[model samples]
Target: MSSLSMASRNLRRRKARTILTVSGIVVGVALIMVLLALTEGTATQTNGLIREILPAQVTIVNATTPTGSGAGIRALFSSGYNLNQSTVAEIAGLGGVYAATGQLSSTAYLNGQTVLLAGIDPSSYPLATNGLSIQSGTSLSTAPSDQVVISDTLAGQLSISVGSRVTLGPNSTGGAPYTVVGTFSSSTTFLDRSVYIPLSNAQGIAGEQGKVSEVYVKVVPQENASTVAAEIQDKVAGVRVVTSTNIATAVSSLTGTLTTVFAVIGFVALLAGGFGVANTMIMSVAERTREIGTLKAIGARSSQVLKIFIGEAFLIGVVGGAAGVAIGAATSLLLSSLGGGAGAGGLGRGARLFSGVLAPAITPELVLLSLALGIGVGVVAGIYPAWRASRMDPAEALRHV
Candidate 1:
């Protein structure tokens, strides 16, 4: 029989031992694969999603200090600081602004239901939120319908739809009603659970006549977005400036920490798997001493014997590595599902819960890492076994079996 075929037969002779060993190695490799994949994917997506939502020219808010500069430290403690209307107007009037929309935000609730309400100028809406889409029914116009746009998830949550009249509550007066004129399906968390109405409507309902909370300024040329933003930060008051890149950087730091912890854990598992492989190979050598002696007696070279043992170890490793990768992915997927399937359901927004970020995903990088790790473990496991096999003496080994 060929060397490979003979080796296969020999391994089959101890099926239970081989299986147990492979299982141990597989579990270890799988954990490593899943961890690495998740880290890499998170870093990549965080940067991308941040850019999409907060483009270069965009500005964001955070709590600030009395000195004017971003409360770089204060932001960590609290948020919900308001951006001024006059400052927004000035920025909009800046030489290169294509459009500027004011954001009036508040933690709004319907009796027992707590939700978020985002106020934007209907006339300048497209400049701020990308665009308001009407998934069903008609688009809401600024006019004076007290009409509001709702998201699909929100619609489902409130059991209200087009033409449904919902009480928006006291226009700082005690009670007022804003009609739900349209329903939209923008996957964003703000929109999903949002009650979007004209900045005028929100102002009137909240008992405030002409005040704004946040400002979204789009550059006239789009290319001068960054330059315009710097001008705003230098001149605007009561506003902490942020862009999509800033959000990406902040979130990436958090995810990076988690990724590092998981990688270290995966390394430990791989180390343990390596030890298991070594023990199994060593045991196989001791058990098959007599067989090895017979082969030597029949003129098999020491190098050949070493090759055979090492070959068996490599096969085990390949199998284990593949299995480990599969397992790691499964674990990640399970965790993701439990955490709400990457949904926009967190409460980090300025008085609003924008589900802008989701959990990390499994990817090809994870699979490759697992396989490479498995191979490394297999080689280590076979070293001693191969050495003993190569050093065997036919005369002495004949008595071993």
Candidate 2:
């Protein structure tokens, strides 16, 4: 028989044991594939969404503080920076400022639960609708009335839908009724829990006329957005200027901390799979020691012996990786299918949902990573066994039972 046929026959000698060993390698490879796919997909969508909204502009905002009040003001008073109407007007009139607009936001309790109510300028909104993530309903298009947009989370919390009326208590100007004209949410933290309203309407609720939360400015054809930001900082008082990039960076940094923790936890599962492969391979090596010696006695080189063993492990990894990828993909799809594709209740991470299915993106990089990790595990696990086999004396091997 040819060397290849003999090796194949020998591999099948103990089918059960071989299958078990291969199964371990497969699970390890699969774990790596799933993690890589998920991380790559999430990072791509989130970072891309940030870019779409921010888009090289600068924002002037009032820094917040805690309001200290005793007895009569029993409720918590959050100190907020309100963008002065005059400051915004001045910024809009500046030479280099391409576009300037104002916005406001406050925390309010609806049915004893906290929800964010944000006020945006509807007329100037098209100037920078990039910031609002419209998951469902229509964008804030109608003239400023008592219409408000809410996030999917808030929608779910309130169990309300578009065109429905709900009471808004931005400071309890009688918790006046507002129609839910639109709904929005970002998969990220920002939009997922917000309520949007026209600036004029919001003003009526807060009872604070001519005051705003921030003024966003887009610079014209200049890489030095910061230069204009500096100019705004100099001209404007009681307010701070921040670039869209700056806000993205700050939010990204905070989210990154959580991602890092999850990444470590995800990687630990990979390590556990690796250990399983190593343990299984080691045990297989011990059981097949005499057979390895027999192969070596017949002039099979050390490298060939290593290749056969590693190849076996690799085959197992391929099987497991394939299964794992399918499972992970199904999970992403499932999330999208459950009304997560569109509307406020959908997945906020900009995942493309089709036919009510959130598809987990399978990319080339993930495939490559899975294969590479499999080979790495196989080579690592084969080392000790290959060494032991290489060191066996041919004469002594032939004498064994």
Candidate 3:
């Protein structure tokens, strides 16, 4: 019989042992796959959230004060520093600039509850955010003054809706009453807790009429963002500039570190599986000592004997890897489904914060990589056992039986 045929027959004779050995590999590979999927999903979701909420490619803020690294999204409610409103027109007139708008962020109270308030220009602000996407009633353009658009999460919290009259001002007890002309929904907490009003109204309310918290600028199509950001920093005095590339690089650095940590964990689990495979192969060699002697006496070369045992290990790797891929993919999808479902159908701001569910991304590369790792572990584990079986003397192996 050929070496492959002999390998197949030997494995079939020890079905229980073969199955147990493969199971170890399957578990290890599956764990690695799931970890990779989760990390990939999180990175993708975070980047998408950044783009959706802050669509502008370049952001300008006051250099005198510290702000969120990119566009001050995390500093959404802070009013510590301000930039001149005329800076918007100056940046807009610059070369390679497509659009520019200014915004003022501050705190407002709604019936004793603190909320984030944003003042945006009705015309130019929509260009930066791709429109606030009002879910009900009219936008700020329709009722520019004394009208506000509230997020669905905020709307649900205070039991307010479109056309409902609400009071918002510096304090809870004393404030100006404004009609809620529109309502909007956002999957991210950054936008969910916010209430949007006209730039003029926000300035009046915050007592910073000629100042804006930050400026959002869109680069002209086919223009380089880094170049524009550099120009903005140079031309605009006392202002800090952030570009989309900077944000992406910062995000990548964080995710790369996270991926490395997960990879080490997965590799450790897979290493344990390799040890199990080695032990199984060693035991098999011990049990088949006499059979191997018989084969050697029948003119089978040591090299041929080695090939047969290695072939069996290869088969085990292939089967285990395939099975592991299926299990891992299914488990990832199940967890994603459960996580996504849990965040829905709940009321209030906390629920809304958890509503942005990121599903696991299972790419073809991940599957192939996992399968390759399993196979490699199996082959490496079998090396010593295969070598020992090949180098054994016929008389020495046969005398034991």
TM-score of 2: 0.68
lDDT values for all models: 0.68, 0.60, 0.78
Candidate 1, 1-401: lDDT as tens digits: 56666666767888998888888778778767666766666666566555434423576463352322223312322224555566667777778878877766664654335556767777776765566567888666867567777777878877988888776653333355667878877554434566777777677655555666667777767777677777777776656676655555666665667677777877787777778878988888888899899999999999889888888888788878888877877877765555453444333332221113334466666577678789779878888888888898889999884
Model 3 C-alpha lDDT per residue in residues 153-195, reported as the tens digit of each score? 7899889989899888978787888989889876665576788
If scored against the real structure, what TM-score would every candidate get? 0.83, 0.68, 0.79
lDDT score, candidate 3: 0.78
Q: Pick the candidate with the highest lDDT.
A: 3
How many clashes show up in model 3? 0
Task: Give the residue spans of candidate 1 off by over 4 A.
Answer: 2-20, 47-57, 62-80, 110-112, 170-174, 188-190, 207-209, 220-224, 341-358, 399-401
- What C-alpha lDDT, on a 0 to 100 scale, does residue 212 get in candidate 2? 79
Candidate 3: residue 106 lDDT (0-100): 85
- What is the C-alpha lDDT profile of model 2 across 179-254, one tens digit per residue? 8877776554334666778887776666657877667677776686888888888876666676656544544454
In model 2, how large is the Cα lDDT of residue 335?
46
